[model samples]
Target: MSYPDLLSFAAGLLVTGALSGVLAGLLGIGGGGIIVPALALALAAMGYGGDVGQHVAVATSLAIIIPIGLSSARAHDAKGALDRPTFRLWAPVIFVATLAGGISAGLFPGKVLQAVLGFMAFFIAANILLPFLERLMRRVHGSATAQRLCAAVIGYLCALMGTGGGALSVPTLAAFGLPIHTAVGTGAALGVPIALAGTLGFLISGWNAEGLPPLSLGYINLPALVLIGGVASLTAPFGARLAHRLPARTLKKVFAVFLVVVGVSMLWAAFG
Candidate 1:
């Protein structure tokens, strides 16, 4: 990249990191919903291949989620909100699913990936915007088999979309009778395995692919990954602190609007 291009990329990452941190804390989201598309736009604009760019963004976003998920999970755990038993039961299947999803991501075309992410984003936003729809979502229960199935599905889907598990996990957990706080905490914790397994899969899948940018390790962009992950992790605590004082509902509504924009934009990029 040229000096100017590098500057632009850094600036974009800075903004993305800052916003992701605040949203993670303020909304109980893992922030991948915000990060993935933002990275996709930046990479594409920097002249990465149309398809490769989005895939890299997705993989890199998943990689970056490691820190944010860990931090958020720790905070929630400290608050006694994370459901450990649920996480324990769900982890193994999620590991397998994320691995499979990561591998499968390479088989699909860019358009397919974008369509998948766009639809997932739309669903996420809808759940937030329309409480009734969220309420209508199926709820699981104390059954180990049900939790395992839910985790496997969430892990697979999130891997494909480059999201942390929060978007899917929280609602599913809530449906299973976990409190919102507990669900969010559990979701954050679950993201660790999902991200790790998916990251490894993407790394292997993208290793020999053509048209990757400089400093890329497979699908992961090292510069962006390091900068965004570091910055977002640093800022998450501040966001958590702010959450104690700020109006969560207002923040979440704002996030929902942003999510809608992301979904619509990705769909346009994919099909338009």
Candidate 2:
């Protein structure tokens, strides 16, 4: 990239990172729902091919989530809210499934990945916007084996979508009869394994792919990761503080609208 283009890219990353961090903190959701689609669009604008750009975007989002996930987990742990037994039961399967999903992601068509991201976003949005949908979502609370299976599915799908798994895991935990706070805390801890394993898998899978962007390590874009991660970490505390001052229901509605817009755009891009 030319110097001017490099400047533009860095600027975009900074903006994206700041927005992601704020939304994550304010909404108490993983940033990947925002990060993956934003980066994919930005990369496409920069002339990267659809499949390669989406792969890079997903991988980079996972990489960026590592530190943030760790920090959130620590915060939740400090509050004594993390469900250790649940984590111990679910982490191993989640890690394995996420790793496998990340590795296999490169083999899928770009449009498929795009559609997955879009659908997941819409699903989350519906859960938030239409309270009735929550009543309809199947509640799976059975044997330990069944819970682990839920974790595995959450991990795999999160890897494919470049999420930290909180969006899916928290609700699953709730379905398992945990309180909302405990579910959120446990979900934060679970994100750690998903991000770490997903990053490693993507790195290995894309190590030899052709036409990667400059400053890339496999599918992960190093510059984007560093820029976004650093800025996000710095901005998140501010967002968290603001979250306490806002009406959470109002915030959820606004965020749900944003997700709907993003979801529609992604699906359009995929099939357009």
Query: In terms of TM-score, which candidate is strongest?
Result: 1
Count backbone overlaps in model 1.
0
- RMSD values for the candidates in order, in angstroms, are 2.3, 2.5
Q: How well does candidate 2 match the true structure in TM-score terms?
A: 0.88
Off by over 4 Å in 1: 128-140, 243-255
Looking at model 2, report the run of 10 residues with the lowest lDDT sum. 132-141
- Candidate 2: the clashing residue pairs are none
Candidate 2 per-residue lDDT over residues 88-168, each given as its tens digit: 999999999999999998998788888987887788778766754345444445579888888889888988889888777
- Per-model TM against the reference: 0.90, 0.88
Question: Candidate 2 lDDT (Cα, whole model)?
Answer: 0.79
As a whole number from 0 to 100, the lDDT of residue 130 in candidate 1 is 73
Q: Candidate 2: give its CA RMSD in angstroms.
A: 2.5
lDDT score for residue 134 of model 1: 40
What is candidate 1's lDDT per residue for 70-184, written digit by digit as tens? 8877777777877888888998999899989998899888778888878877887777667553454444345688778778888899888888877778767766777666776
- Pairs of colliding residues, candidate 1: none
